[model samples]
Target: MARYPTITEIAQKLGISHSTVSRALNDHPRISSETKQRVQDLAQQLGYQVNSSAHAFNKGESKTIGVIVPDLSIHFFAKVVRGIQTVLDQHGYCTLLFDTSEKMESEANAVSKCIAHRVDGVLAAISMETTSFEHFLKLSKHEVPLVFYDRVANFIPVPKVISNDYQAAFDATMHLINSGCTQIAHITASINLNNSNNRLYGYLDALKSAGMEIDEELIHYYHLQPDSIDTFIENLLTSHPHLDGIFVFNDYAANYTVNVLQKLGKRVPNDVSVMGFSDEPVATHMTPRLSTMKQAGDKMGHLAAQKILAIIQKQEPMEDEKIVINPELILRESTR
Candidate 1:
């Protein structure tokens, strides 16, 4: 590989010392304007670019932000990444992304790698099984500011950005009740997840508020597998017999459920009403559009980025601000 010219080479070409070249490139006020302009013009002509790696090595700040998500395949995480990039780009900062795919150890290892890279900060959505927070402290001790988003650590002192899960679930359940769904069932992800637990509570709360019995049989914990979901739903149908409504944890699962229900010779909304969360691409593109909760993934990502920046700049974050942006109920063909 061809080696690029160094600052010393550029200085030699411009008939100046390396220190003068450094000051000129960095726009130091002590350097005369004419000298700085002359050096800059020469450096540009030589195709000079500062070696950021070397600069970071000396300064100990990479000017890079590391972002970790559960999985990039999920539409919601992808939307959040786009929003994070938008904000990071505006501030001349670069983003480094890591996908944990819901693995607890992967989440910890990703954070360790980010710290090793000397990143200025980190933005992470804690993994589904992340219970030990020792890995996070490694970053904190280095003074690398971290902002948790979507799924986060309740015990971590870092500021977090998340959708209003309780209210969103409450409103989604209420919608089912308003549709006259007396036997509503919920298909949700890991029961240990705060959002998942909150959604379950919301469903039960809605039932109580509507003067209905909270049946334990109506709750189903979903494990991702074609056969598992099929059997679960089949058992649900066979056991409940009167189930009229279903709330899925996410659009991908909802899409799969729709397919499964069709195989069982049931029509959506007409035979059974359904609702999903995250409003993924499939939600709108499906034949019978899904009624779901809309989380502002992009907005949440942008806020997470901004919060990390504020913390890095030593600006006092709204200390008491635990931002919970409300989720919208997107009404469509899936519900009446």
Candidate 2:
């Protein structure tokens, strides 16, 4: 492969020392303006690009941020990534992405690889099964700032950019209740996740406030694969025939559940109402447009990127300033 023009090569071509070339490229005061301009113009002509890898070898960081997400197939993560890239690009920083495939081991290994690459910092959304945080300490030990978004490991003392989950869930459940849904059921993800736990509490709290009984049978929690989701939802509806409303973990699952309910002869918003979290594209595109809690994925992504930059630039650890973007409920055809 052809190599990019180097500083030494530029200096040799211009009959100057490499140090002079470096000074000129950096716009150092010692280098005359004429000399700097001449060298820069020549460098541009040669298609010269700064070697971030070489810089990291000599001065620690590669000026690149590592972003880890559970999976890229999900559109929400892709939207977040677009937002991160927008902010990172403005600051002349590059992003390195790693998809953990929602596995705990894969997440740990991804962090290790990022550390090995000498990234300036890390922004992550932890895996579903991740519990042990010892793997993330490598960045802290090396003084590379780490920031989390969406699904976070709160035990780690890092600032996070997250949606206002509790309030969103509360409002969503209350919406269902106000819509006259008396038998509401919740399909949850792993209870270990803070957001999942908060959503559960929110659902129960709404029930308490509505003068309703918090039935344990009304809530189902699991970490099933995509293929099994339909079966699970089918079983859920079959067992709980009285459930008039369902609040799902995400929009994809909610969509699947709606399809399953339709197969079982249950009409959405008539026989049953459905609400989902993270209002992705499917919400608007689905047969009965979904009612959902709109998490600002793009905003969360931008904030996570900015958080890492602030922490690394300041040479400080995570602080109390956890930025929380409030989620909005989008009422649609899925709910009456």
Candidate 3:
């Protein structure tokens, strides 16, 4: 194995005292310019390198950031990861990423891993099943900063970045109404998730504002799973013949609705217009394409990264700070 030169070896090679070499390497104000230059020159000549671990140990920082999200395959999370890496990598910090698979247990374990790794900071998006946030307090008690983004925990008073879901959903509902859709139906999920709950409210408020009576049958709220979702879609479609518009919780469900409609001999837009949230990649691939709300995942991810970085550097206060991004509606073939 090749031997690497150390500070002591550089001192010996330069015929200087170890303390002088150390002071020169650290660029102490008391050290003369000539001595510092000589120490650097000798270090370069002897292939001597400073120990990063020792340097960080003296500064009481790990220089590593931990990131936790519910799922990575959901293109939205993937975009956010890119934004995080862009900023953290540029600052010479390492990123430790964890996926929760949308399970609260997995998210809790990820938090423990971050604490064990002694990360300087953390950026997280809580899982849909996450209601108890006691695990997050561990990072706070340890003095490691944590920032939440997108799917956040409102009970925790920490820095966060999220989009305006209520307004976005309202806009989507208004668009469906303007497109000549009456007797609309909304498909939603777990009320624990702010995004899901706000979306449901947005739809109801839009209908109420338009003098449409609130019908309990028009709203579908349940724990969504792929295998069982198809069966539910069929029942909703068959039972609600008057529903001319269907606003789905996400892009995946919207696509499923389109497929089920086609199989039931229903024409999209002509028979039933559809609106989906998040504008996922597959939205444009369907026969009539899909119209959706653009959630600006990249922007959300970038802001989260910036917030955590600010806390880590003490450039901004870490308490109760939040940044909200607005979402836009995208007109496409699925909606008239």
Candidate 4:
């Protein structure tokens, strides 16, 4: 492995004072631009990793941000991270990733670590189990700008970048209704999540508008798993007994629904109709291609980066906007 050079070693090699090399490494305004460029070029050649811990302690700028996500294996969160990386990489910022795996304690610990590291900002997709906002509030006390993307805490007053969940669900439900699906059923996440509530509201709104009675029993809410969900699906079809259309709140859940439907000898769109949110890559390739609400995950992630960066820079007073990106409803074999 090639040895990395420290500032002191670089200064000795270039026959310059350590202070001069330090100033040049930081591109201090006092240093001549030509000298700064020369130092940077040589540092790049020598593969110098600026000791961010030491530099941030001295200058108070970490030049990095922390991202806390509920789960990285999900396509939606992964795409959100990709979007965040695109923006951060362009702005010369690095990211520290923390996966909470939907655990409340893990999310809390991740927030503290981000604060201890003195990240310039934080972009978080809060875990589903997070009910208290105190963990996030700690970041504010330390003056760390925070932005929420996708799943978020409703009580927190921060710039949020999210898809129009309510509207997206409404649109998906409306699409199913238009496709002659009258007896519709909804499979949603636990109601504690703001996103889940929004989706549920949308589904209800569409059903009400169509003059269909909201059958409380037709709505299924549970933690996601394979075997557990299979039981839910069986109960859903057996108890209600009249479900022609089904709206799953997320793509992953919808995929599982299709799997269960197949095992139960139900043909998608022919025997029943289905729709899901967040047009994950697999939605298109399902046996009966899934109709889904397409959220702009990349757009939300990039916008979160921009807003957090702006907050860190203390840019001119602008309205704290709740950016709700509209979703697209894609029709496919599942909802034909």
Query: Highest TM-score: which candidate?
Result: 1
* Candidates, ranked, TM-score: 1, 2, 4, 3
Cα TM-score of candidate 3: 0.86
Screening candidate 1 with a backbone cut-off below 3 angstroms (N, C-alpha, C), the clashing residue pairs are: none
Q: What's the lDDT for candidate 1?
A: 0.86
RMSD of 4: 3.5
Which has the higher lDDT value, candidate number 2 or candidate number 3? 2
lDDT by candidate, in order shown: 0.86, 0.88, 0.85, 0.86
lDDT of 1 by residue, 109-141 (tens): 999899888888999987767778899879878
lDDT value, residue 45 of candidate 1: 84
Error of model 4, residue 255, in angstroms: 1.4
Q: Which stretches of candidate 3 lie over 4 Å from their true place?
A: 1-54
Q: Quote the lDDT for 156 in model 2.
A: 80
What tens-digit string does per-residue lDDT give for candidate 3 at 201-271? 89988988888888887777656575455676677677877778999989888888888888878889898
- Residue 13, model 1: lDDT of 84
Give the per-residue Cα lDDT of candidate 3 at 291.
Answer: 95
C-alpha lDDT of residue 76 in model 4: 85
Candidate 2 per-residue C-alpha lDDT over 39-119 given as tens digits, one digit per residue, 9 for 90 to 100: 999999999988867876687568789999998988999999999999999987898899998898999998998888888
* List of clashing residue pairs for candidate 2: none
Candidate 2 segments exceeding 4 Å error: 10-16, 20-45, 52-60, 315-317
